[model samples]
Target: MFKVPPRPSTSRIPYAPLPNQGNDSGATPKASSPARSHRSSSGSCFETPVAAPSSSRRLSYAVNSGIKPSRPSSVSKGRSSIVAPAYSNLSSAKKPGEDPRPLKDKAYQADCIQNIYAFLESRGFDKPFDAGMLQLPSSKLFLKIFEFVMKQIDPRFKYGNKPEDDILDFVKGLHYPYNLSRSSLQQAGTPHTWPPLLAMLNWLVQTINFSDATSGPGTTAAQPAHLTPRRFEAGPLTNLTSETSPLDEEGCRAVFFEFMKESYNVFMNTEDETISDAKSQEMMQLFTTYFEEARQEVALDVENLKTELSRKEATLERMQDKSELKKLQEDKEILEKLLSDLIKETQRGEKDLQGYEEVLLDKQQELKKCAEITAGIQEDNALLCKRIQEQRFSKDDIEHMEEKLARRKAVLQMLKENRMHAGKEASKVEIQKVKIMEEIGQAAKKFNQRAAR
Candidate 1:
């Protein structure tokens, strides 16, 4: 506004400084000036509200506090206004060959070919890599990288920077490069030499072959500059051999050095053959001890089997004996039954004998009674004989006895007769006696009466 004079009317209106911008007079400016009829304007001048960082009062305050230096140039009021959208602080890809994916952009970095080559060349590119570097996390990755960059023209094997080239292109197209600014490509180790080295190889091979091929002016092989860079494939690793060319010397050096180092490490640290022999001896001793134990166990098992077989044979014998004894028991049972039958018969015979004895006793008893009867008859006969002897008289004796009795009776009769006869006589005699007594009594009485009288 110093170059172009401002109108007097501009001073009368209430002026406001635009967002974060102050007036030349160092005064607080606001948007209350209704019209900008004559304002000291520049490309940086903008009319924004107080609600933004563009607030006019805050710009005056910040300038007085020395929070920021004075603006050097002008601002355009009409440039594309990009209000920074609300966002979490995050890194983003800003280049053409950049990836848009999240988190991955942080993993690997992309760099221009120029910077990577400069750093590697300055290191003389011949130092044996620090062995400690290989033990680090991702160290093997660096090793794989460096291994890819070394090239060879061996027909028997394929080698070149093609693999690194491919990887570089991959990173350039896929990862964001800006965030890689903090990391020195040196941190990548020997592989940092890859891209420019590859480009140099391409240039070198082409220079040799191309210069020779195009040495004659009529031969024309140059193409349009827009043609893509020539591409080559990566090569396989190899051992040191006399056939390796001067160009191949570096590659052979790297490979053998790595291999020798590893072999040397193994030799120094590994066990010797004598130790191995001792281990083998110890194993043999253990095996011998176990073999003896196994032999004893097998012998014991054989003895046990023999004893078991004998026991089984004895059991079979016992079973046979039991079968024979069962037959014997059956036979004995039959004998016992026969014996019992014989005893029953004997008992019956004895009973019969007792009955016979009783009958005999009864017969004897009857015979004894008959004998007694016979004895009694004999006695009676004897008595009769005795009686006959005693009598000794027969019928004659009876007749004599009878004649005596008759005589007695006759005598009585005789006596009676006599008495009768005598009675006549006696009667006469008694009559005579009575007559005599009566006569005598009559005489005596007569006499006595006579006397008494």
Candidate 2:
């Protein structure tokens, strides 16, 4: 007898009620069939069984006999009658030996189920099955589903006598990212082993979707029409083809020569003395058609080449223009920077001119005072000249007059020296003023030039 492992006490396995079954509160349910009992036992071995209601005798009987209890009519039909047990709901706070690994969330499992169903429906699978069927401990239906999905990839592919080997081979060929051991593959339909299998199926579906999206008719149509070559239409031998032929003009000529050679050989070696005129005409016509097609093909090629060359030349010109435009832009930026600097220098020069104008005003005031003093000195000199001209003296008074004249000459010399020193200082000031004015003129000219530009 095969012994089954004990189920964990933390979880509960829910069973879907049969469609024909009815929930009658008053009536007592019959005992489960042997097959139902066996399935229930297996389910119990995999997950903890839910507690039956103590008040209901039918529920207690069903639990004792390994049969799922029916729910009241008030309960929702969409959900199973069995209440799923949770770790938090346990009466005991602690367990001595519990598996530390966490279980997959219900939401995740539901998502997987929905995706699997959607994939099957898109692949045109017509058979009806629910999530409950997938959760059952059976491999037959799941294997069939797996095979159906594999067939979508390759219709001709078939499972051989060794299905395990075939499955391994197919999975290996796909270069599946997840490692799939033989034991996992063997127990694929069981609840304990379904997660990896589900993952694998989902991956395969995604790959198929991706491949279809990448290589479908829509993708082909999205490509540029000019990129693909035009295919020649098939026609009879008498028709003059305008498109390219399989053989070139040289090949056609060779064939014609070969035909002529064979004809000559036949005429010389066989009973026939000369070739038939109709056959010769037919051969010539065929060769002529071939040559015409070859010529047209060559012409088409030349035209294509010319168009390509023109396009390339235009592209090259655009590229060169772009480079020149970039260079011009850089040059413009440099010129703009220089112009800014020149403007700043011009502003500074204007400021210096303002200060120089103030200094020039002071220098003009000093020149005015010096001119007044020179006018006073000129009056004094004029008086002295008049007095000297009017005076008449004897030989004894000549010495006294000479001594006074000497004193006047010394005063005149000192005055002359003062006038010369003042003139020299005025000249230096004028030179400085001229230099400043020149600089101001240059700055203004440069500013005007830049502004015009």
Candidate 3:
């Protein structure tokens, strides 16, 4: 009959790892997170916020001038909806009783202006005014003023034809003479401050013109009513607040221009102060963040250290267990070897016992045969004695009687020899049986010893 081979047992198959499988102890790592994926993706790149330098300056001027910049008609709705936090809110809130010192001081203002003049002079600008060069027409102050304005507009601007004529022509375009008061210029006493004052006026004109050009037409309509520049001419210095006396013939305009320059300097100085304040605040916040991060990092380090200690403890325990298991395995192997030796000795003892039993059986058979022979010899001796007692008195009978007596005596002698040989054989068999029994007791003692072990 054709028989199919039996299939191999499933228990014999080696184990294999499955795909995307978790461990039996539930220690598998989790999948990647969405946030991590997004950060790692090739398409993600950060953009720096565009901070317009001109915009902040313009915004400051607009706040003071009542003239606001026009918003774009096509501005994003999302952008328009997002309201920036007020500048006041950007600083930390102050206590009600904390009185702040004034942002500007007259002494500080004068000192700052002096510093500016000193810095300019130090850079080799003409200080002929201080050198007693008081005659305005005799100096190159006008040309210097014109060149300064041109450089402020464009560093590469050159005087193509008559430099003076070109400068005058540019001034005419800005309605210069129209804005200046004739009497004020003639009354400016010492012509020393003329060139700088004119330069200041021209700089202001340029600033206003640039603002107008950038802000577009609708900017004028967006002007706020309350915020207006404080005028120092016939408006405030003389008419409104006559608390101080005039310094010169063009006292109003001179004070006004001086105020403009002072205000501009104050603004610039305050800006630097504001930057310093911001930097200090940033450093404070950075220190705060650094401490917080340091604390968290220290905590993490402590936790990691604890985990490492625990892991090392577990590893130590595992090593100890391995050592114990190895000792147990060695002991088990030694016991197995001892058991195998005992079993072999038992087999050998059983074989020796079988051989002794066979010898005892042979000895018992010999003893039985000797017993039968002795019984037969005793019966024949009794029969022979009875025949001798009944013997006749004839001569032939006497001769037969002598031969019978000799035969009886020989039979007795042979019987005695057989009896003695049987006794010796029985004694030898008893000794061998005792020896065999002693050997069996020894074998049993050995077997018991093996069992106890």
Best by lDDT: 2
Give one digit per residue, the lDDT tens place, for model 3 in 222-297: 2331211222323112122234333323433333333333322233233465553443333334333433554686
Model 2: per-residue Cα lDDT over 131-246, one tens digit each = 56655426777678777877666554556665655666555444343456668777777767776666556555555544333221222233333222222232112322334343
By TM-score rank, best first, the candidates go 2, 3, 1
Please say which candidate is ahead in TM-score: 2 or 3. Answer: 2
TM-score of each: 0.15, 0.26, 0.18
Measured with C-alpha atoms, the lDDT of residue 232 in candidate 2 is: 20
Global Cα lDDT for candidate 3: 0.40
User: CA lDDT of each candidate?
Assistant: 0.37, 0.50, 0.40
Report per-prediction Cα RMSD to one decimal. 71.3, 40.4, 54.0
Instruction: Report clashes for each candidate as comma-separated counts.
Output: 13, 0, 0
